[model samples]
Target: MQSNGPLYLLHQGQVVKFGFRVERRHVNPMDNLHGGMMASFCDMLLPLSVYRKDSAVGPRFLPTISLQIDYLAPAPLGCWVEGEAELLRATRSLVFAQGLVRADGVLCARVSGVFKIGPEFTPETAKP
Candidate 1:
């Protein structure tokens, strides 16, 4: 969701700002939360957070080389887990991005990802 990302975007430079709400389905067993979801969230948003790009389909059409995640604390269910991304550095093809997810105003997870920027994607329209 573009709206999810870019919660507070500063169009002043090459970096884009974003955010997303972590729903209960994003939680894991043990009744706390799942690490995979946090990792996935990081993987999905980190690129946008840094590169200043806005297309969510970037993942589907573009490519992600890898995602590194670090779990810091427990993320509770039915709570709003917020995330933020910032671009640190980049090369011609390789770009680095890092982000964090917080629940109930507490730090829950940290993540970094490398991505290859490519052509943007647009969803195909369906005929009714």
Candidate 2:
């Protein structure tokens, strides 16, 4: 998935917004955005919703525990995709999140995930 990125991010209070442009690499044979690409994008977006720089968790490295994605429609090639993610809940050791993926304002997919709260995040830990 690393090769599929250069994803753009925006912060809106408790919601994290991600913007992606569908490129040649992101599309399937039918010229629609690939399901795998959408899944990976949601996976990256969900954990970000739990980040709180001022809290004890404080931008921790979150390891995904479970992820579920529902494909609702196809995002055709060359379209812009936006993913809005928000935290559903957070416990002592886990965080749950949900997100909606839209292409040019039309719903394309729904996502939910559970992640394990891990060590504090650092640039070094983000490397593949």
Candidate 3:
């Protein structure tokens, strides 16, 4: 499991949807969803989005080079958080993506990321 989250794959073909429930551990001191957790969720969302589209060939192993998250609102605990991502661009060695995180129908965060899509991620070249 690449993610520590209880994330689930919703629609895996064209548009990728990943969702999870906000638990107590995901909150901050004020009982709002932690920014770090939200950023982590976005990190997972982007790569999964890229891989879902390229599934016919194989799983795409993308490592984040840069990730940016914009916090728009707070997500209370016990809310259902859904992440949807779009592949903005793909080059020979990089992939760019952006998405949104919505909790209980309210937009809570927006995220964009750049990922490296090269040999380092492949099983043959990865170090164990």
Candidate 4:
């Protein structure tokens, strides 16, 4: 379960920074972070971002309903990729957020996603 990353938070509060260390496995044949891994990283990052802001209720799963990514540049292997997400809007049942991933201060990708939220996401309802 920890395989996707040793993803760690740079700050412990609502506005958070997540950093991922680029490894050989995360690269494409061209030696850049793979597109799929970037997408997966965004998928994982957004929810964690949402959770950070909502941690007062304990963590809840924000199941992504839609996700879009714009690859601006290739993140070379051995670089530390970092990104931050903010909750843009939230309704009774859905939440929206956007984020950017960068390497060496260069934008690597931009991502935005919508997630479903409700009682189904409550901590007690979460599957172990």
lDDT by residue (tens digit), candidate 1, 19-127: 4455555666676767776666677667656544543324333368878888899877666667777765666666777787787789888888777866544456322
Per-residue lDDT, model 1, residue 41, is: 63
Ten residues in a row with the worst lDDT in model 4?
Answer: 53-62
TM-score of each: 0.69, 0.89, 0.86, 0.87
Query: What is the alpha-carbon lDDT of model 3 when measured against the actual structure?
Result: 0.83
Rank candidates, TM-score, best first.
2, 4, 3, 1
lDDT (Cα atoms) of all candidates against the true structure: 0.63, 0.84, 0.83, 0.83
Model 2: per-residue Cα lDDT over 44-88, one tens digit each: 878765573225555798889999999999999999999887777
* Model 3 per-residue lDDT tens digits across residues 25-119: 89999988999998888999988877787643236568899999999999999998898988888888888889999999899999999998854
Q: Which parts of model 3 are misplaced by more than 4 Å? A: 1-3, 55-58, 120-128
Question: Distance from true position, residue 29, model 4, in Å?
Answer: 0.9
Residue 98 error, candidate 3, Å: 0.5
- As a whole number from 0 to 100, the lDDT of residue 127 in candidate 1 is 23
